[model samples]
Target chain A: AQSVTQPDARVTVSEGASLQLRCKYSYSGTPYLFWYVQYPRQGLQLLLKYYSGDPVVQGVNGFEAEFIKSNSSFHLRKASVHWSDSAVYFCAVSAYGNEKITFGAGTKLTIKP
Target chain B: GGIITQTPKFLIGQEGQKLTLKCQQNFNHDTMYWYRQDSGKGLRLIYYSITENDLQKGDLSEGYDASREKKSSFSLTVTSAQKNEMAVFLCASSIGRGTSQNTLYFGAGTRLSVL
Candidate 1:
């Protein structure tokens, strides 16, 4: 079974500061990782996804995630964040043969002015 | 660019009542999915259809039934609404079954509240 773990339930950061939201997964097979973001009263939108190429994948709004197989992690990063970037971010994992995509508990980001 | 629409943006039901949520996609995707989202818990897959009339149960299929009568539509039914239950139901679709086309496009979501 593929499972995603987002250790941070909530993160508070000042605007224009660097950010990193941690994510770890447990999957025996080749993993397909994704980052999805949900704003208030909206559906989740895909931020980025990783399958096999470069370990680091860039996403929308200057967001990126690095897939570390040895650590079983795919951590989302941003050089600087804006107040508009505050939202609930979820990390998900799936495999080639698996029909189910498992999501993490989600990390609610709050940007301070 | 395509859109996924979920009917009845908000639903209020009484305990023990049966509720149905409808979803339609214009992307002509081959797969559709139903997921439930709670406050603290993340999204949980309830059911999915790989093609028209094909239903696959997920880890949280208990007390729920799903139907995919057409390639562009999928519906989910709650067997019984629990009292004071509140959650958001999300509908999503993908192009195909392969890893290359696995990106899911989601609807705005339907919020459900039970009294």
Candidate 2:
């Protein structure tokens, strides 16, 4: 079985500061990682996904994540954050032939002004 | 671009009552999914359908029933609403069999409150 772990339950970052949210997964097979964001009262939207090729994948709104197979991690990063970035972010994992995806508990990000 | 719509944005039910939620997608995707989201728990898959009339149980399908009568619509039913079962139910669809590369598009979600 595959599982995702997000170390931080909540994170507060000052606007214009760099940010990083940690995520780790346990999967024996090749892992396809994804980052999803959910705004208040809205459905989750795909931020980025990684399957092959580049280790660093860029997503919408200047978000990016790096897939580190050696560490079994896919951490989301952003050079800067805005107040509008306050939302919950989830890290998910899936395999190439798997039917379902496993999601982390999620990290609630609060951008402080 | 397509959209997934989930009817009854909010539902309030009494304990032991049966509740149903509906989902519709215009993406013409081959797969549709239902997931339950709790406050701290990320998202748990309840049911999914590969095609019309095809139902598959997911990790959290024990207390739920699902029907996919048409390619564009899927519905979920709670056999018995638990008093503490206050959560959000989400509907999503993908272009294929939910492979590694297929992106899942989601609906806004239906919030359920069991009193």
Give the per-residue lDDT of model 1 (tens digit) for B5-39. 99989999999999999999999998888999998
Q: What TM-score goes with each of the models?
A: 0.97, 0.96
Worst 10 residues of 1 chain A by lDDT: A94-103
- Runs of candidate 2 exceeding 4 Å displacement: none
Clashing residue pairs in candidate 2 (N, C-alpha, C atoms within 3 angstroms):
none
Candidate 1 local lDDT, A1-113, one digit each (tens): 77888999999999999999999999997899999999987779999999988999999999999999999999999999999999999999888866678889899999999
In model 1, which regions exceed 4 Å deviation? Answer: none
RMSD of each: 1.1, 1.2
TM-score of 1: 0.97
- List model 2 lDDT by residue over B1-115, tens digit each: 8999999899999999999999999999988899999988889889988889998788899999999999999999999999977999999988766575678899999999999
